[model samples]
Target: MGVQLKSSSLSPTVDHILDSRRHNSCLTLDAVPKFACRVKYLNLLLLSAMPGCCFCEGMALSRLLLLVLVAELAAASSDVGFVFDGFTGEANLSLNGYAEVTSEGLLKLTNFTPEMTGHAFYPSPINFKNATDGRPISFSTTFVFAIVPVYPNMSGHGIAFALAPSKELPGSMPSQYLGLFSKSDNGQASNHVVAVELDTVKSVDFADINANHVGIDVNDLKSVNASPVAYFDSREGVLKSLQLISGEPMQVWVDYDGGEMKLGVMVAPLNKPKPQVPLVSFTINLSSIVLDEMYVGMSAATGAATGCHYILGWSFGLNRDAPPLDLSKLPKLPRQGSPTKRSTEVLAIELTLAAIILLLISTAAVILIIRRRKKFAEMHEDWELEYGPHRFSYKDLYRATKGFDEQNLLGVGGFGRVYKGVLPTSKMEIAVKKISHDSKQGMREFISEIVSMGRLRHRNLVQLLGYCRRQGELLLVYDYITNGSLDR
Candidate 1:
């Protein structure tokens, strides 16, 4: 029976050739070569109709023709590969998890949703080994992709271009595994998997080199060869770094030479020519890891943080260089809605300014407290140390007497004004005498007599509690006698 090819963009002439069942006879293997000749003739007609069709690039038409030719050869020979500039007419891709083909023909592997996994693969398996020796065959692939993080410069996990024995990796995990392997299956030789990882997070369990790196993984996430995300500048003769989460489109090229057992990976910004130097190069024998038939695809995963991984174009060829992607024909990336790095810098500046203002306010409050304490400072002398038990702080006295306001005055005698007061700590009522400044001449003798009298204790006489002296004031504390002080 003839293999049916379903494509919406194919001309009626090509469609008739692909769907031979409509002719009431099954096409044999011999007809495939003859069908290829018809396809080449249809390509000339398709090229002439390109101006009338939606596709503006003539190169895109050639790429489509090449993909159909390769798909035919895949049936008869081991050289199997295909190309897709966009997913508009693609119907044979196998999608799982969050993977979807967008209305704009973009193959979105993962979205902003957290803790998700997605996979997109060619529907059929490809021959990866030689029948004679069972040795691995050479292959090349190139893809254009972009990562749009939910936050600038931050994304959870990353994406990987993988080749595995099965398209659906049962029991696989998301996040650090890139949806290819689970914790139990990782690093097992039976997996028979090879992948190129574009990691954005540093996973210690996997011994990742850094947060941003490209690694070549074989049956395990622990890469045998890895490098920081960077590209060589041929003109500058230096290696320049690239940010994978910059929300810009980038191209990656992977090539494996079965003869030399060498694998090379290169990366660069979209529309830029491939770098002369490869980002990661290593010697690896794939014959033991690659199965006879395997599926080729891309897988991605998200952790606590997430970014949308999009594939704009892809091409693969066995025993030949994969066709270059037509950047002009790829879908445009969605404009980033998340805040940029500039906004984060602005927030940092605002926080710093707020901290400075808070510090200034705290310093001013401390200075005000110090000034107020000095206003109520008491005079101290060595002799007063012996009367420490009988002395009261000026601050306490000032607060107790309410600054000696006229309302608290009990009487004005010849010595000074007697004010009704209370002890702050003891909450005991007392009487305070503020001696006139002119009484300073005999203040020492008077204070001595008062101290001596304080030693006297009688129920009928008011008791002396304590005393406080300021630079220009002498204050005496006496026990309070209620009911108008017996004279009022």
Candidate 2:
């Protein structure tokens, strides 16, 4: 029988298409990388023939690339497990019934209500990979889950990780049945469902040893093998039973080999090195339950008293040769009282208002800069008009200094050197102090002399004559002081 992998976005019905040929189905989460698929070539060939179904690029492009990895399942062993990204959201799973992963990260299989039933299935099916002739294949599965009470009160019913003949759990009901079988199929011999039950409440409807126990169900409510869920503490050398509705996530490890199954429960505190001693060990022929390839997932329900059931994290491996699971690698537990969808709305409004305030501040800064530039230009225009007659042309000064010849230079001081030169237009002898271009003090002194001396009238002090500007040099001129201080 050829298994053609299908592309159904989030449909467990990807297995539903084993009955059809040349059909389309979406890929599974981990199944995207395995199985040397010849079916991919077939899918491409079929799409080429049908012009109406051209896959275009857009949001669907990413789906197409992932879907590209879909291929036929080979006749080989199947090993499926979950990563940290497994319980991210509803986006990562193919949920059914009322089952969903809440935004707070809880994988709620069924809400708390009377007669509520929910079934969640992983998108892919597990193959025992032993032989098709009904040979018992040994496998192991580790599950960390919780059964919460409806506040101040515990609930009836429980949850189970099931290996079913098909994806459908037909005739399933709530309570003692645990939503795996119905009243009609309760005691029936032909039911191919093998469930490992974590039951909380006792039921008159079924033979339950206690309110809290782990059971192995084969087509019936009566457990073929059962044990009260307990942890064996090595330090104290005692086995302790746990309250199933304690709200803390409990870890259960199951390993089956050599016609015998072993289960370990760690309820108090789970640490490195799995509990060595098995809490429950029983021998049964899983070969009898194996009628076909099984779909492995969790099923939960509520009846009478209801509590929120969660399948936080789970992993499975086939055969004894596979590597042991590192519980640390499993996805994180759902956080308690995390922000819900309603809180996200409030956050969105706050973000929008902050963005508007930032935009207003940026606009005001740009306007202020432009206004300051305009005011500075108006002040410079007034300064030029007031000092018009006193400022000599740069050309007249350059000619009078003869490109600042050496003989015309008289003396040098902190600011610059004084040069004696005669103006060509009026034959007026002038002493010029050429301020250094890069000197900060020289520029300050030049501005101080202009603003202070130009407005002052003095007879004893040297008269302020004029000034000139070259490329960037500040040239200051004053009546030559010769007879009073120098030997002329």
Candidate 3:
């Protein structure tokens, strides 16, 4: 008959397309298998088109695409590295990581000086070059190192982290290698290298022996060489002269914020949990090197009499492609307290003195007013003695002036109004002077006119016959003179 087949023993391809079943009919089997296979392939195509339907599958595909994108991005960014070669050409290697030169192989690096040598690590005999054509590499590198002696009396040379274009190693490295130190015939100093030096060598010019320090060299090779653009010992402890004995590891960190071109340095002891003791710190403008490529590496050398130095481990990180550093993380200083209680008391005393002055002025004003009133009253009484009181009451005075009518007014004076009237008692024409209550001069003028007129009895002069004072009003009676005052 036809080929015998068990449902459980179906081929993988066929099983994938069709469910378990056993049948001997060839026509049914062929048609069913064909339909099942077509359906399975169609479902796969639909799933691929509608990716959301397969959540897990879609996520996996997305992640793979993301990884590829990130890799492409990183490759496109600037490349950072370290160079180690003779001081003649550019260094071919680009290195980034933790770097150190230790006494007992504690921190080791690729290019390190052998032990028991009086020379420093990364001896100047070994020059590292960094070369990039047009693209500038932005990176931060640190050097952590310690000196170790072959014998108890032996000391090692100093080292430097240098940025240089040449590959030719210097001939005469100083006692500490003083990284980049070289003598010149000009006596001005060798102007070849730029370096940040960590010097351990003792000098009388420096403050102390165990002093730690950091310095920036521009166009100079010797440690003591003078330069205008260099900053040594600053408030931030960048080029401190404090020394660290052999076998003690010191750590330094240099950071450059790309936007500001500011380079910052921080130093600390390797064993401490906190960065309490800072060895070096500073900021440099990197705008000039924005387009220039630089080699990031360490360099050291031994003098004619001394041996080679040792460099243990070395590494660096390129932050040129990384995000900008946040300035808010820096520490803030404490605010000072307010002035002391003694100062506050002094201020209070000054204020009290001013208040006393003001009080004295007010009291003087009041005394002046009282004295003026007393004088006015005495003058009025004197006028009454000379001119005598007006025999007429207030009613008579008002009637005589026609209830002080405007039509009866003779003229206006600075003090009050003068009105022409006929007194009923004397049946004689006269002038009634009404002094304004609001005028201080009106009161004085009334007293003066009455007193002066009452003293004289001359025909040519105006006669002051009587006067009335009541309810803040003053009335003066005088024989009516046909002519006005001489001044008028």
Q: Pick the lDDT winner.
A: 1
User: Which of candidates 2 and 3 is the stronger one according to TM-score?
Assistant: 2
Q: Please report the TM-score between candidate 2 and the true structure.
A: 0.51
Off by over 4 Å in 3: 1-138, 150-156, 168-172, 176-179, 185-192, 203-212, 221-243, 271-279, 287-291, 302-309, 320-488
lDDT of candidate 3 at residue 234, scale 0 to 100: 39
Which portions of model 2 miss their true places by more than 4 Å? 1-86, 90-92, 258-273, 320-488
Cα RMSD for predicted model 2: 23.8
- Which whole-number lDDT from 0 to 100 does residue 8 have in model 1? 18
Candidate 3: RMSD to truth: 29.9
Residues 1-488 of candidate 3 have per-residue lDDT tens digits of 01111111122354433232222111122232222332343333333432443212464664564355334433333233232211111222332222232233322221224321122232221111112222223456554554443322233444556655433333434444353444442123233444665544443443323323455544453333211112334346554332333344455555555444444555544432224333334344443322132334455433222222333334344543222222222111111112223345677899999999999999999999987655334224453454454434555666777777889888888768888888778778878887747545556575666667667888777777776775566777777878764213
Q: What is candidate 1's lDDT per residue for 1-488, written digit by digit as tens?
A: 01112221222344554444334333333343333343454454344433333322466764685467556644345545678877765446899999999888889999989989999988776667765466778889999888877767789778899999988888889888899999999999999999999999999999999999999999999999999988887778878898888878889999999898889999998877898678898888888888767889999999898989989888888777787677788887764323345446777899999999999999999988888878787778776777788888888878788988789889888777889888789898888888756445776676677788899998776788878898888888888887645222
lDDT of 2 at 480: 74
